[model samples]
Target: MGVHGHAVGVDFGTSTSLVAARAGRLPVEVVPLGRTTRSFPSIAGFRGEQLLVGEDTDDLSGDAVIRSAKRAITQNLETLSVAGRRIPADEVITALLAEIGRRAEAVDQPLSMARDLRLGCPAMWDGAQRQRLLGLAEKAGFPIDETTLVDEPIAAGIAWVMNRSLFYGERLEGRLLVFDMGGGTLDIAVLDVLSDGPGTEPEISVLSALGAELAGDKLDQAIAGDLTSDLAAQGHSSSSARRPELFTALVLRAARDAKIALSQRAEHRIMLPSRQLGQLPMLTYTREKLEEAFRPQMDIAEALVWAALRASRLTVRDNRSAADLRVLTPEALRGDVDYVLLAGGMSRIPYVERRLGALFPGAQVFDNAGVQPDEAIVAGLADTISYRRLNLHRPGFDFIIEWEEGGQLRQEILYPAHTPFYSPQQVLSGQSDLGFARHDRDFPGPRSGSGRLRVRSTSGEYLGLAVDNQTMDGLVVRFGNRMDFKLYCDGRILIRDGSGRALHMRVDRWPVIRGRDSGRLQLRSAVDREPIVPTGWYMDKEYAPPIR
Candidate 1:
């Protein structure tokens, strides 16, 4: 299997990246990037003209290595400095993607011939970030397009639902809350799943998604800071302080390892190398200490969950404003949620599960059995490619365009939720006269020469395109000027005036259907006769014990 005709799914994570592939109806396989492990570090190192990535960067010095390059996309940073060289953030990301491609091809020769490649990203990434990643993937030689991106939590949900149906013979429906806390971010999504008659695929709709940049890495820093303070109190010489950056890096790595170890045991020994920390004594980091360090971030994470639930519009016994809403004790949601699926590496912590279990007392909460939390996203991403091949995917949100007219809000539905993004008749095209003269007798527009337009989802979340007169007067002009509006399958909206001037805005979100559903067209009779047992790494893993 050269992956010549396979569907590849990539989870371009904050700390590590994973690649999975499915060929025809074959089981999805996680492509190994390291000698023994599947994970590839999301870091890059520069030495003169030579570039190193992932595990290869492990030996590089702090000044020469770029870690968490993914954060650059979120911060909108244009360049990163490495080894006294300034490099474009896009180039660094592209290099990482390119390396992944190379490794996948190494495992399966000519993986470059893969028919499709899909990437998983955070749900909260705006349009610009998504587009930037898409561009970088293309630069890396992946056959990616606008529809290649899938929200991480959505991917995790898909994996959980598919795993349940295929292995346990259980059909999960109703509302689901996906709590994904990875190395760099915490993303929470509330989705509604509806099943039709037996054997028919369930309809999945994302009610709301929210995220914050608070996760594993932040906790690691807190632990490191605590260790540094402890060392200072012991009268350890500050000689290592001269190379503060190097010393901090070593401590942080030790802290991260200790955190992971604490997940499995009550305590972990964190021993920094003498070369890195001088003659410091071995440190024993306890789970209690880790919990204390994580408390503040955990508090923020709990509040974020509440915010996401409220935004989902799910039924609650008492709906209160943010000011009055109880942060952690969201008893109102206990009866509303049917299941809580934990995902991301950070979710493996016992404390996280306990917290979620306590919050959703009436609901079943658990991680996908046999599936590693970090790999869930990639598995779901690969399964999505398989679903699309069978025409069993649908859009998750309704696309809408809005404007102001006669002091009232005017809007039009460009694409309704669950519609196929590639449907010929559904694709937005052509020009429509705004009839500015009819609405405003004082034609030729305002002296400022601008107007406002917004593109958003039915959930009331804006999708990044908000053109106001202050920015562009010629496009949203008055005086009955005709304009063309075209929405591409990739979430790109292009507007053109009669004068041929054009304005482009990307929807800042992916159009791929998140949950599960048949395409706009009816499913094939064969699909209805036999349920598709999605094959993936999850199939062989033992189920996790249920959390009641």
Candidate 2:
């Protein structure tokens, strides 16, 4: 899809970005950038009239640079100031993507660059954020139709599946918990893998998924806060805190390095490299001090894991603690977990690995060998054509409708947030299709505009409405009426009579779509981007035949 060649995986991180590409029968390789390195810092800046990315941001040493474009986009900021004038966040992110594309195409073999891209996103980002990011990438010049956005943790899990040595050759089975604590987000995925006989690849199924904003970047911020107090204790910086840019750069760099260093050694020293403030005294941090600063962060991480496990219907024992992470009792290891694939640089921390390991009694915890944690995600994302086709987009909003059936009233999930819909069900061995929920069946015509449906927010706030198109008012339901029910993938509900006519609602055009059928097939972001074709509209091979 590119003018020259093709690129498969693009791991857009908060603190860095990586790209991987492959040609026919070629091994997947990370594109070299920034002094022949595979990963580049995700820093962008506007110098003069030009936008700068990758190694170019090194010139912004004393100046203010757009630190985290990913975070800004996640917060839905319209524009960010580069130097002085405000530039749109979309333009900034696009610049980064464009730079990556250019670098990827400049490989030794000179990749022509395919238009199709596999973008890795945080598991917690909902449809709104996902759409907004996709729009930004499209504006940056990639083909939107060919691009496939996937959850970061799932990508890591796939990477683990591709390379199973991390399991210590124990023949991994049961629930494989993937805890990805990266620079900007913490994602948790529980997968069920089953092997079939000898030499055949296993099947991976998603059991449940959860994520939070808590991650390594948050720990850096917490460490930076602690540094401010340390400065107060030093008695030198208690006065000269004027140069904010210098302070911000110095603190962040020190925090990141100190966090990594403290993971292995008991003590680490941080030196302030601020030219404006001149050379300052080196700050020494012991493991005890680091633990003190990281306690709150670890508590938050524990809570996220707790919630993710509960969502997956897994229970934990009472002795789950990082400070006292010992061997799990035989009872504790019962039916809980088998292995945990720990991804991201943050997951390498002794506290994180041990703490997460404590939650799963008999599970083996694996992490980056050396500097490979940051490089692992992009490779998994670039494994093959299969990675690009894997789409497990669960709904974000909870939809429930009150209906009368068999002379009694009942309410259940018309569309559950955790249930993925209408994909190539043949890809999986055993899974239900959405065919039952959507069908044109033989039945009698409707008696009236009588179905009563109330849509509400997850917190019980009334937001969705069942409109009657007849008089342009709320729908009124009459008992014993036959109607067709459709739960759209984009969280829309439609009800029609046996004659295939919509009823029980009256309304003008919905937010960013046209016509009923078109609206049901389109998904809109929270920030309102250009409308895109819905994934649920059925692509080629929308159903896959399970391999026997």
Question: For this target, which candidate reaches the highest TM-score against the unseen true structure?
Answer: 1
Candidate 1: tens digits of C-alpha lDDT, residues 1-548: 11225677899988899898766544568889876788888889877778888888777776678878888886789998766678888888998989888988888823467666678888767655776887888788887654577788888887776666544557667888999999888988777676553344556666656677889889999998888887778775345465666676677778889889999999998777777556778888899999999989888888777766654542121333232432324676466689999999999898899888888888888787337888888887877332432211233444443455678765555445433222111111211111001112222233323354433433345443223213321225322344444443223345443333445543323334322231221111111222333233333346521111
Candidate 2 wrong stretches, greater than 4 Å: 1-7, 22-27, 81-86, 108-112, 165-172, 314-334, 368-371, 385-548
In terms of lDDT, model 2 sits at: 0.58
Q: Name the lDDT value of residue 442 in candidate 2.
A: 29
Q: How do all models score by TM-score?
A: 0.71, 0.67
Tens digits of per-residue lDDT for model 2 on 114-176? 544678888767556776787777767665531366678877877776566222333445777
Looking at model 1, report the run of 10 residues with the lowest lDDT sum: 427-436
Model 1 misplacement above 4 A: 1-6, 23-26, 81-86, 109-111, 237-240, 314-329, 384-548
